[model samples]
Target: MRREEVVAQWQREYDSFLQDCMNRDWAKIARADEPNRDWAIMFEVDRSFINNAKSLLFTIENRLYDVLQFLLDKGADPNSSLRRYNSDRRCYESTTPLIEAVKIGNLESVKILLDNGADINFCVERNLSDRDVYFNKTRIRVKEPSDDLYIKPREKRTDDEKMYIWKYSTGELANMSPIQIAYNYRHDNIVDYLLSRGATMKVNIRPSGIFPFPFTTLGEMLRRCKLYFIKEVGLCEERYYALRTQVREFESTKKLLKGYEVRNAVPYPFRIVSTAVLLLDNSLEFKFQYMALYSLFILEYWNEIINSKTHIAAYAKVDDIGYLICWLVKETEYSKSTRQSLGLK
Candidate 1:
């Protein structure tokens, strides 16, 4: 179905659900039957047979604030987690209504959920795919023969010779949190509000690609900026030709230093340079991406770097890069000499 059709259906379902709320036995009317017993084990966990989203999640995704408020008041769980099978990944993925709100870029819905006791730091879990488990390009999984075949030992096969190999697909427990998801989806207002509410990073996502290790959202943003510099600035502008060596060194040093904590080990100058390019760039796309990187830094080291009293002081012991970030973010004036020293135009 088309996107509009799907949205319209959701609206219709929500309307019917809202109307049913006036009835005293609405709970019974919303409860799911068999095949969905796993998720709808409770009365407040009603979901459609179609999408398997909880009523609260569906309402939040659709931005139906009135219905959301009514459901929350009617005892719908603010921290309810829905576990549904992902056909694409061939495994179950878990999501919360708060995550849904963040994904839809609805700050109001996010605030409502958080205000109503939703877990601020909740992370969604998606079961690992075959490629993730094998660390390979192959996506095929070997299907073991039925246990019934093992029950009756074949002519030459002894029962003791046969062993059942149970393969358990490990899921990423530290999946993207609401704040991280907000950053990913470029919801700046939601990111700021989540930070204000004491949200922190809990994600450890590692895609099955060249960089097969977990990195912070800040590190990812830094890498993105570096790519932008290489492609747009270095290749396109003769003025930045001198930066090729610096960029290459930054990439190598980043890879070498990224032992365990990729975020902490990212070279300071590299971080500053990458972030500076993004911050100074005129592109609207880079501006949005910059906000995500900025928000991530705030969450990662708010007290130690961003909001620290000493970091911004004249005699601050912090790295110059940290001071520069804090300084530029505040939009303070920089002397011509200072701008030239940092190679900023």
Candidate 2:
């Protein structure tokens, strides 16, 4: 028989078996398998049937296990190359059965795939080509900002340009790890599950692939919390002032009121700043200075300045003159801003 004829014959037999299964005529389906060579494809690369099985598993259909068992018994490959399967218009890159299970949040199916040797760290292509074609038709041209302190102005857009930008930004084109997809979708349960299973949340994966500073998981967690006001507060006191210096230039004078508000909310900003300054006295460095400035900014916003007496006491106790200079410069800037705003100086 020709390939087309064989395919047609296989389709007939597979359809009959599918109908029997749907009608709960298990005996008929069991007896339906015959000597048709085309029918063998049902046990080989019937993408539609495999997708149906996937859907059944996702929906917790009662006969899913039986269907899966039957397919396996007939020689369906669990790790079959998805490139050969043509079914509903789902992306071919996402054809992994394990990925389907993950998308459906079917823990049972996931376990089954894992037990059957599915790759846990599999990297599937995302639908970038489609997005690229769409974007090519309507690209936007953005202009660089004229000033560092202000937000950059967006270029005027035609409808096509706007649509292109929206589609390009919203499209899922890059291959994301299971953990990243879970996070993107706010699937907290899946996120926790993947983490517990040893998935690492790497920030950079290009060129040199440099991990962010303070690389420990705990440090990363803390960074996400945004609670650490300054490098000095959580870091060694010796380097605190040095770290503060680096971030000082980026401070926004216009946003001082907001900074003061933040300072008032937390552990008094004064104590926080003092702690950082103390740390800076011990370890002076540009990184530490930058972190210290961040802490100071938080303290300023919170309005948590220490009284002069405590500030002086802490200053006197620290031995490093250079550290004091950096601390003094930050204090001077804060003082100038506060005085100007409050009419104190």
Candidate 3:
């Protein structure tokens, strides 16, 4: 047969396969998109790449896990990737079948893919623009009228490093691994499973992976707590005095923390930060206590907070502690010397 004839035949087979998928015909869907019996060959006809879409990718996208496994068993490339334009980020995102499975929260598919030839650490690189760098640096979160917080063009970065995202200049592309995507979507099972399978986390970590939600920055997290208290708890000036009285109790909390360090003979910045994080929790009965502990924590460790990127919230880009306190927390009682000591201008 001529080359044209062969191309026409393959197109017909692909169309037929797609139709079978639509018709929910599992038997027909088992057939490949090519006329030839080489099941491993990815279905593009006549030497054409054709957008890099593959049958395995499609099966994963459509939640056809059984079909996905069938293809993998038939020697399909487990790591076959597809590239598509992400309209929200205004950039091209390249993803693989495993990443898609993680997105859909299907651990079975994830395990199957990993059991096959899928690369556990497969990463897709997207170039970060100037705006991306800026947003990550400033840690800005935009609030909608619906009272929900979101950031535009969310980018994932390494969780262990400090301002590591900043090291990437404008137009610098960064790699986001599969484990990172799992963390972003809150698929804890997948994360733990990946870890068990020796999947490395050096390449994964969202803006606020340590927090309950994907908050862009520490300031954003604090703002969320403030808004929740004001809206749900009716935070008002009338309660300020009572809140202050409750805040005095933070002195004991501070002393307890200090005694912990002295007894252990080791400084625990993470322990301190975690305690501070709990103070911001809106589920607490006394939401006002966040004010006092927050202030005390800053006053006690402002220098350590600003100087060490690895100590506290690295993704928050907290280059200046004093500015963060004054602007986000709105503290007014600090004197010039006190503010100066806290690194406030």
Candidate 4:
């Protein structure tokens, strides 16, 4: 009957309302008696982000990407993240949704997070021994409890120092990033998209002993192709998809490389064509065996066709390399007609 009791009851109702929303049961959220609650907590911190008191955005991060867009549109903080937690072990974990998306090779969700300003450099928790992420927080100190002892909780360390330490000792374990995860997962397209959007590839990565990498985006792809060939992995699953999108992305990549205009980089496209050709020599059994041959003619004649002033100007210039290649092929038919009329070979 008292005002405090009434507020408590309302809080309980709102909690239930939020819980439903977190589960993405939109019907239940809409059916709630509290009409204002539907949109009210759209901007509130999702304290239940992890298990309890973690984050709210965790709700739709991976599964309900469209719902995530709605929440972002309605003013949810795009940079929301939570410290890792391992409830089974009752310890902290590093399970941010972006990292999870990258791990799972979900390009769409990864792009959504990155497009909305998710931290691409967000490090995966360094659990070299598979230790709990928050072992430091769990580690009990001397409890000096005074400024004269170690720096007090309220003072001393700069914000940067107060957090994220031991980066160097940990190797790439401490610097695991979204692009690194994508590359490791063989989600080549996600890696390229992340790089184009400014995710740095220079960070130290896991198994650093393997290759001291400072690879450019395309360089990494080519490097991966080389590794696959050396390892004799029968077929890269991505090669199938790569055949569908690589030439388009590859042309776009060439446009990007021109920013440097390094003379050496001029031959980089040719090398990719050649690399595909060499890989095709070994076996036709590899998945996407067709791309190697397809890429060869494109490279061998791209300059000749584009530069010869041969009247490809009639086809639609949609900025699509695939379309351009098809158009070029079609132009050859027209050239044959003109040659026949002129009695040329």
Candidate 5:
């Protein structure tokens, strides 16, 4: 009954429980379950914090739900951080149970965690900040006149304010909303679901360094349309002409359109860029090069427009295409006309 003896006894009990869990000896675990089974002992195990439920949720393995249910029944804490077992290279420094659910797109797992009181907005110190400041900074204001007559009197507020005005702020993951992540990954279904569940679209969430001219989102949409047309319908002159017409319409709307629209358009140009890159090694030198150069210029113009804004939200919704375009131009050779067309020396 010395202190050391008590400590030794607890250690033995903990090790036994760990072995039972690892071997999945459910009978032993149940038998060993005392009145207050001291489930914290399981947390002390080296890999206990790492949930098998996560792998199951992500569909990396099968039958995860059953395992998770068993663990929860045995007293697994859903709020527990798995950083101890997760490596630095893994997505999001340490994997939380909720994040695992999100990545897997498993509504069941997400529901279970929510029911069990999992912190949906929990911020584990991975590379990105938990409360990204990205959402809070996004500007989605309705323009209103101010009292000042001499100066341009437009009042602006954050998207958070607009959401509050609309009474759409019940979900727990408000800090870094899951919808934002869905948008980042281009998970259309998830994005739609999140929006249905009260996710508000902010005008300023466009990816930074994009521009208004040839709007990035519009370009992206066009690119996707072209790819679909080529793969599904085959590349016909009519289809190509149709896409060009849309691009022209986009270009004409340059000054009036927001960055979000541009980011949304990025899919169009992205497809064209992909095709042009593939064709670069073939016979159509000038045509491919021209398309590529035009794409980059459009991206550059978008970036300039975003950066010119005083607020960060102005460029938050823009995609990463601008940076990609800049990189492409730096790495490739360009024609004289291409350079001149893009206003590059």
Candidate 6:
């Protein structure tokens, strides 16, 4: 690729990351034109990236786990508002870090955020209403006019006052609960983990101007549609050991490749940023692409080396490999930080 092409690629990914449906203020604006969303946005708010290269690189490495842990350990409020004072817009917008983390599909980061008291019930309404709406043609409305689910005067409503639908004060979908974000993004392991940690199952999926049912949990959505957020996070007890086994297998396979007279063959490291970039475009069928990449890196590289040299050279682009290694250094530093967190070796 030309220098300009490389620059453009970086620009595209950066633009996507900033205005990503996850981070942007969806607080009640209709997302009619946004193809990924069938739901209308009720409002709009501007968002900007944390552009400090040092800081962003830190996050890309720890994937936000380190900063989250540091904050939580220091008793930083987990439910803190993400108030972004856009000097350009001359306004303020805020959402929680948990919502951000869930959108990015960072499972470990989300786990720490949840454990530290992030609000499970915080909701960003897909669309707001001046009047009550029914769900699935059912007469159940949000139970009150001038609906404001963010109301904090009461500790808890009775069971009769069921969680009908998400309501937002900020007027953006960025306020969506962590679990809903996870499920929408098809982060199955994250969705499951958040539910286990008490994230609410209720999410609003009703089409706008349609009769909205006040009560619908994600569990209900799962039943309503035969969709799957399926994932296997591997063994719990063997998290460390499993990674070791993987490295061992990687080394063993490397030696085997050498014995087969495969020269200059570098096994692809399964670093998140490096590998995840390949499948970023094909997010809906998330896991399948990931599995394909894993197989290609582990099993098919040598075959490509023997049979299709041109494709192998393209696959192992020097710039791409360097980018992966640059990102990998952050992970190594993150591991050191995590080790300190656990007071373990």
RMSD of each: 18.1, 15.5, 15.2, 20.4, 14.8, 23.9
| Candidate maximizing TM-score | 3
Tens digits of lDDT, candidate 6, 314-334: 222223322222223223333
The local lDDT score (0 to 100) that residue 162 gets in candidate 2 is 53
Stretches of candidate 3 off by over 4 Å are 1-13, 21-53, 129-171, 203-345
Q: After superposition, which runs of candidate 6 have C-alpha atoms over 4 Å from their true positions?
A: 1-64, 83-94, 125-175, 205-207, 218-345
Q: Top lDDT: which candidate number?
A: 3
- N/CA/C clash count, model 1: 0
| Pairs that collide, model 3 | none
Model 2 TM-score?
0.40
Identify the runs in model 5 with alpha carbons over 4 angstroms from their true place. 1-62, 73-75, 84-92, 128-345
Kindly list the per-residue Cα lDDT of model 1 for residues 1-345, writing each as its tens digit: 555655565556556654554343446434422233332333333344323346677667667776677667766778878887768766666888888899889888988988889999887775565336553343333232333432232344554434221221122232667877776676768877888898765443222211211223344333433333333222344433343444344345444223223233221332333344424644543333243234233323423443321121111111232344333433325578765554355
Residue range 1-345, candidate 2, lDDT tens digits: 556766776677667666666665666645554443554454564434433444334323333555655554555555543432224534335446555556656556555655565555554443433335654454332221112211111244556555543433333323334554454455556556666666544221111121111111323322422323332134454454454453454454433223122222222222222333323334434434443355434434322354311211111111122232234334434456643432223
The better candidate by lDDT, 1 or 2, is 1
| lDDT comparison, 2 vs 5, better candidate | 5
lDDT, model 1, position 243:
39
Q: What is the C-alpha lDDT of each candidate?
A: 0.49, 0.41, 0.50, 0.43, 0.42, 0.39
lDDT of 5 by residue, 79-187 (tens): 7655433344332345567656666566666656666766654543333222446533542322212212102111354564545432222221112334444455565
**Residue 172's C-alpha lDDT in candidate 1?**
28
Model 5, position 163: C-alpha lDDT score: 51
Candidates 1 and 2, the one with greater TM-score:
1
Ranking by TM-score: 3, 1, 2, 4, 5, 6
> Is 5 or 6 the stronger prediction by lDDT?
5
